[model samples]
Target: MVRAQVLHGRVLDAETQQPIPNAQVGVADNRLGTSTNDDGRFVLSIPPAYQAARLTVALLGYRSHTQALPPLPGPELRIELKISPAALGEVQVTGLVEGIVREAVARIPRNNPARATQLTGFYRESDNDTIGRPRYLVEGLLTVFKPDYRQPGDDGDVQIRQVRKVDLRPAGQAVRIDWAGGPFIAQFGDFVHRRAQFINPRHFRDYAYRLGPGSSYAGRAVYVVAFGPRKGNSRADCEGQLYIDQASYAFLGAEWHYTAGGLRRARHSGASSRQLRVAYQPYAGRWHLKTVWWQTQARLPIGPPLNYFGEFLTTAIDTAQVARPGYVERAQTHDVFLRTTVAYDSAFWAGQTTLLPPAALRQALLDQPRQQRADSLFRRRRTGADSSTVGPAARPTPRESGRLGFLGRLSFGAAVGLFPLAGAGGELAVRYTPAGSGFALRGTAAVATPGPALATSFDYQFVLTKTLALRLVTTWLHGQFEGEGWQLGANYQRNLRPGHRPLYGRAGLAYIRQTVAYPVGTFDNPDDALRVAGTKLGADRLSARLQTLTEAVLPTLGLGLELTHQFELVADAGYLLHLRTRAQLQLDEESGFFLTRSSATINLPNADVDLRVNNQPTATLPWQPQHWLLSVGLHYRLRP
Candidate 1:
């Protein structure tokens, strides 16, 4: 067992009394250490043997320090870190209008190139005309994990899959995004990089100025940057202010607005802004990025409105490879974004892969002794157990019970009948099951009319294993021309091939009642002569239907296709039933001939009609039909 002792201390700037968060402290020989917390307090758990020796303290933006311990040590030590002007690089440029990018870039040591991954965060405002006020807000977080490729011949080919999270919500509720897709990550990276390129250095050259007296961020320089389209360059989506730390020449933070625009005006034009404050400290003779706090706000014209505020905390840096013996380093980053009271956290850990060629890797493996290689490969396969063992280890099994489920069906159809007359019908049904129960409850509603009809229904289905189910249905229908109808039905269905192609065959018996009312016509009106015979009408029907429905999901593309057929038994059994029907009828009267005759109706029963609809259904039964649809289209996924 290893024994450890605690060492505690606080870090403060030598020139200013402000506490320095994210200061690194560690034992010289042992690996135990931690960065300063928000309050600048840190505790290092040193191994027992190292407690009696001196401890090293390092801050990224400040100079490093070492404090020797007293002969007999206590649990805590007090240390003061000094600011060295040379240790912290001098400010090469400072101003509000436009700082000198060349000067700032010059300060970064050529010996150790600074590299970082970029990400974008966006928010937008929403407009709701129906409510007379904005109703919802949408926020999104996008990250781009790009490796440094400053020179040619560097590894340029990279994998594009890297998505963080997306959150969308109304103004007050919490937001969340499911991070499962890859293409989204690439899109976000492209957006961020494109905006980065639009910010003109010339704008900063004019706007840059030194800090003014009485400014809260005084002593810290500022610059105003402008971003717009250039000749042959696409329009930029960003513009903002950049704040720099004069002492260390590091970017303290920036505030900017982003909008999507082009040479011609576009519908999407809005602003997203952010403020970032960053501080660095010197540790072990090297300056490292310490703490960075970022807050963002955005206004979008799409959907409802949206706003977001987030902050990131960067901790340790480890170098990947040691060029010289006894030297080692690596890098790590832990970041989190906050919105109101909720926070989402993510971490990234990466190291340099071996640069050896394939031939070298093969030679290295071959260099190992044959017996040793065999042992390494088969280590996990060797098991110590009785060869005759045939049963699993003793363990308690939880009771297995099937859950209650529901399936809903919505159907709609339209028909054109005799003489400028049309009929439309819709039906919606929902069925539910109870655990281990053989019966289910169903409800339904339906509507039918000469011109337009509406219907609704609720239903219940009791599922028996994978292939059998029982259903009960209740339906109500109303029509514009026809009065109303009510139906009660029960069905038994069996499903086959539930894996690839699902086939369900159902037979149901239903009792239906329909009623109609018509206005009486005056005897003098010859056009209304037929109405007198049917001043009031009613119909009662008993029907039975057998239906076969099949649906298949395209395994590779995530698409679905369905087919259904229904056989109806109505009226007298002797009458031939039509599977699908098409009918046309016309009526005309010839007054010049001194007689009136109605045209005969023609009916083609069970005729097929092709209709197109969305793959997903709407909330309402028989889901609403689309006004227009595009068929035979192709979709492509692009990544940056």
Candidate 2:
């Protein structure tokens, strides 16, 4: 009788000692394997077919670990993974990078899969909009029949096993995503299996490279190569880092992004931007494409940022490449944007596979249970002997559950700003955002005791992409200090972030119109004291002006400790525009009622600059009084 044993383990980072979730663990030639869960724990059933086989554990950005079959006196295994040394340091090695590339090119076939294999995979995708919300998400299970590894383009076929999805399309979105054909897109991302679909093997000489230190992958060392277009070659190009297996000179994985040259060359290609990555591992004997991730963003000429993100995670379930005649015929192969299966079978997924099922997916299939049946299966296996699986009623995840309706998309917020000389004021605001939609509307009512005033504002925002937006605001106010004022403004801001830091650059144009209250005859006398000037007056006067301005400023980027997901620490610092302040003198003709009179536009002192500051009588800001605005405040926006 063959001996079978069950094993449990947790994977962790060697240095941080923190659990590393999503690590893959299995034995060579073994029929069963599993991935660590959120807590970095996994349970594996050692199949009798490979009781003596060694186990392999791997994760992205870390060195892989290998060990003999488990049950080495202990009931559980704890694996600590160290960071890959290849990525630890960076040094210029351009010649070395080019040499490695040459070697990898010649040995591509030997380093990659030689035969075909059947793969079971889970694909999930999510998108973050301008507002930084996970508004769109999708997942699919697939069965892929790959052709010979060397000839990836010849004919790899895919069939969807099951699918699930959720989308919160921000309201009034004219652009609704049609994910019906995304499965094929996922297939194209398999640079190892479908190698020819994206980058060409023969074009390696056209790019430039810079080599970094070697790193560990799948228990082997790999050269870290960074490459992009060379010199004045402004043509479209792929630029990113690559991991090349040092022994066989095969590319184990790569993370690539498009460069400006690439964008220029592909201007007519209908491709805007892409961030892609793919990795492979030795699965069921030979190398199998383990993971493929790609996110594409649509270029907006005048619209919101629209993006598609796809991930493909594969496990070798079976293989039949040698027995098959040629490749699956195009006519026989299924082609599609993956559609969610209207009905899901709970038992089908419960069948053992190498990879752990995603928790959200299991939750969807298990009749909306709070916890999955798999978690119970593990518990029973741990505590009770001779465990049997339990199946739930079959049904599709509710369609209505994915929708974020009117109230769900509404966000309310409040803010208070110190007006320096004018005193403190607060605003109550209501904002509405449609899921995945790039548009938002805000209505605000404000009150200030020092200004002893009441005001209201209506604002609108439309995002063009991650770093850009168009803002429109109109405000009406009445008070003793501010007088009856109405302001209309619009700005287009481009926010550029510098890595994960709080520093960012902002450049935008703005238009402003407002009414300013000041005592008459208060202008600093400049007409040579000898000349007679206007007499002093006790009555107040109102001056309404319109200004068109452009400014460049730096603002902070990133979030504060989230008391609530929507609560944020917001801050801004920058210079306002320097422009002519134009207005008609509406001096109080009688009892504080202003009458229109001829007034000329004013410039800053010496005409060099009017440094927009609170004390500058000629300057009026859209929000606050200070010439140079610096703001740090607690901000909350409804996220539900």
Candidate 3:
């Protein structure tokens, strides 16, 4: 085997000097190529046979660049490309916009290959959390068996060959979307081959076309036609430009994005924006899909918005004697590549022409070796005790339990809780525990009537028997109202069932410091009562903030129902201790309300009546200030 020379480079725009992402970089007329990443960086491995070949860089709407290959071990190459703006002069002068679009659509079968083709490509995708934090990254080498372009409704079959992924979300967080079939998004979004709404001749009446400046794609001058929903069409569709080869009417490339109205009409879509770009290259007298890029922004119901991206670069294509992937090797549409694992092979990666991941992901890839070593050590230490006597079934390994990943020991949940005092609210909970450890950390937040509540706790569990366990829980900074008081206490937890979905009972005592406040309307007849005492507090409403400290007993019951291996439904009911709620009335000059005052004056016929602090002024209510809480939620285990 001959060693390959490694090449590193960056692509930028000539005028703006800004990095150009998704720019095609490769050797022309061969099966060696890769696309630039979001940061405009790329790495290519050149075989000894291609040492004399010149490198080519191209992007839609940009002038293609070519340069001679530099010697091995050289500085990073910088290639800048100038924008090739589409000039509308010729297109406007012709005034045949719709005719051009219709002709292009009609020539699709003639321009594209009618025979089946096999394409082997490298695919990569990254997702960000609502706050733009990297959530996960997945990269895979896959093969696509593309049917004839004229075939109706056959998107193609994909088989993942080698795959690897990393989860970047913080531990104890849940990502509901598993991103199944992510790699095939580009193929499914092929508007040209699929005869998208705006491109189909039958739907031409539903769209209006305008002539645009023509640009070059893959060294061909293409006719740029802009199209959108027709006037009063009332259709949910997109607007974009189509790049059709002027000489052959072949659709070389197209870029389109969803409109705001389309996104609104897509119920439960959560997508605020979406865009896609695809380009085909002429090869062997036929136009073949060369590259595809797609991105979407989704607004989540909770937390931050999520951003998703996917890119596919065709490395090699075979049309002669092409074989389809076997049934066993074919991947299903619902398969999540990230859930499958493959050993990280540095040699394999070093030999493939692939896009370079971002800096953070690159570092994570480098750390894989260290993490594997740690996992091996942990397994040895844990299994050493019964290596000779223990059978596999008797002692389940961490891998069998799906507890080998970074977040294997964490669980997250979201719920709706109903409190007698706080009303209905939403709650989020997170729990983290190390493998083979009885100690865990838990944090929770709730939003309700009074205010949002936040609490953190430390728990230690003791296994008494095979079916029962005891847990000691200590919580602090637990409260219902912001800037109000907090609770610090300990609780005892007992499992009701073992070796099954969780069912438990809790009992404990806690000390709470709280401030209770009420509006003057809390009293039914305050004015009448004060008038009977000949003390008229001149105010329509009287409110007060009262502070107090109390000790309370807590009792709760909880249960869980397994939904999937990684998720469960959980419910709990609990009660807080009772206390006498109080408030002092005073007059506020700004709002004309009485609140928290020590003394007050009552206007009389001749003079004012002075009222001092006394126990007789207190009002006794018939209601208890205690609270009862019931919560139902979904919990997810981070491992699987």
Best by TM-score: 3
Across 184-265, the per-residue lDDT of candidate 1 in tens digits comes to: 2122222112223323343333222333221112123333233333334334444444434454444433444443342123
For every candidate in turn, the CA RMSD to the true structure comes to: 21.9, 21.9, 17.9
lDDT of 3 by residue, 266-339 (tens): 53378889888887776677887878888888877775466887888787777878776754466655456657
* Tens-digit lDDT string for candidate 2 (23-47): 7776764334666765677666666
Give the whole-model CA lDDT for all candidates, comma-separated.
0.31, 0.51, 0.61
* Model 3 whole-model lDDT (C-alpha atoms): 0.61
Comparing 2 and 3 on lDDT, the stronger one: 3
Local error of candidate 3 at 226, Å?
Answer: 1.7
**For this target, which candidate reaches the highest lDDT against the unseen true structure?**
3
Alpha-carbon TM-score of each model against the true structure? 0.33, 0.48, 0.55
Model 3: clashing residue pairs? Answer: 130-304, 130-305, 586-594, 586-595
> In model 2, which range of ten residues has the least summed lDDT?
524-533
